[model samples]
Target: MVDDEDLIAERTPLPDAIGGRLREQLVFLAEVDKLKTVLRQSPLAAADRRENDAEHSWHLALMVSVLAEHSDEPIDVGRTVELVVLHDLVEIYAGDTPLYDDAGRESQQEREEAAADRLFGLLPADQAARFRGLWDEFESRGSPEARFAKAVDRVQPLLLNWLARGGTWRTPGVTADTVRARKAVIGEASTPLWTMVQELIGEGERRGWVSPGE
Candidate 1:
């Protein structure tokens, strides 16, 4: 139900932006600006409005840089940060699928792969391949940096939920057991962070911010 005013600005002439590879890069940047409007289920700390994909990516990069020391294995902090940045850029087109949305999860892979193809193709060929490689690395979580990046990615929502007094924890059908099961991957990257996440869930349950048990 978006009105004309709510629509994103029309893509017009490049104006004075320039041309060639720089123009392609500019177009890609402009396209990803839509990520700022693609909202996620998680609320911001203020609890006023839900956070968007761009903000989420930015936060993940910052958290990865700041918390690299907590990784279970040594990771290239710079590489992990780049992974986080590229990870959600696809959501600019595929949209943010909430972690608990079973219906959405069914088609998530297909939709996102298409998005990656189209969006990353906006860049020059070499840059597109490199960016797509980084995105795939993050998705695979095979590398140490990817694993640690994922750990922080999972933890950020938990922190937001705790801070916002339930946040998505209060969503129907979300419970302590579910939270723990989904978040168990955190331990694969950082033992201490996983322990802290468990503490937060325990406290959340006691405070009635999260459902108890399953």
Candidate 2:
């Protein structure tokens, strides 16, 4: 269990002239503010604008809280939320790679590893270690929390694309087979959620919002 006092301690404000661990924490916070400017390919459910990295992370965190019960394995909801929220912070520098971009994915891990070093290194030593651990765990998909967080991350964009009538799915190279291949990991975490994903994809295809499989 996480200590409530540790959470409080982490949140306590630092003085303006502080020049040690507190300064590092503040710098990390300021640096992460750029995540709000990194736009993703998916559009918002109710708006014309694309969702940004910060908003995408926030949404996934909330989804983890609300959808934890759907996980096939028991999970720590709070830890899952933390994983989801922190998973994409590296994208502020690495940029959001489109899900189906095979060329971009070839170098995505290398780019993100560099981004993680710079971004997480902005924190004090201990805090940087903890943040990197969370980020790495999410990337590895090794834990139940990581698996569920990843499932939600994938589902959120699928949901948005369905609602937005194909949204980015209408891009030239996107196809049903490619989407299914990319999203198959969701099934490993939650069959229920994966079922919903398939249903949405089927409906989108029927509506001409998603390209039919070849």
Relative to the unseen true structure, what is the C-alpha lDDT of residue 159 in candidate 1, on a scale of 0 to 100? 93
Tens-place lDDT per residue, model 1, 1-214, is 1122432322465766487899778777777888888999999997599999889999999999889999999999999999998999898778889988889999999999898998888789999999999998888898999999999999998899998999998889989998998899899999999999999999999999989995
lDDT of 1 at 196: 96
Error of 2 at 173 (Å): 1.9
lDDT of each: 0.88, 0.87
Cα-based TM-score, every candidate: 0.92, 0.91
Q: What is the lDDT of residue 68 in candidate 2?
A: 91
Regions of candidate 1 where Cα sits further than 4 Å from its true position: 1-10, 15-17
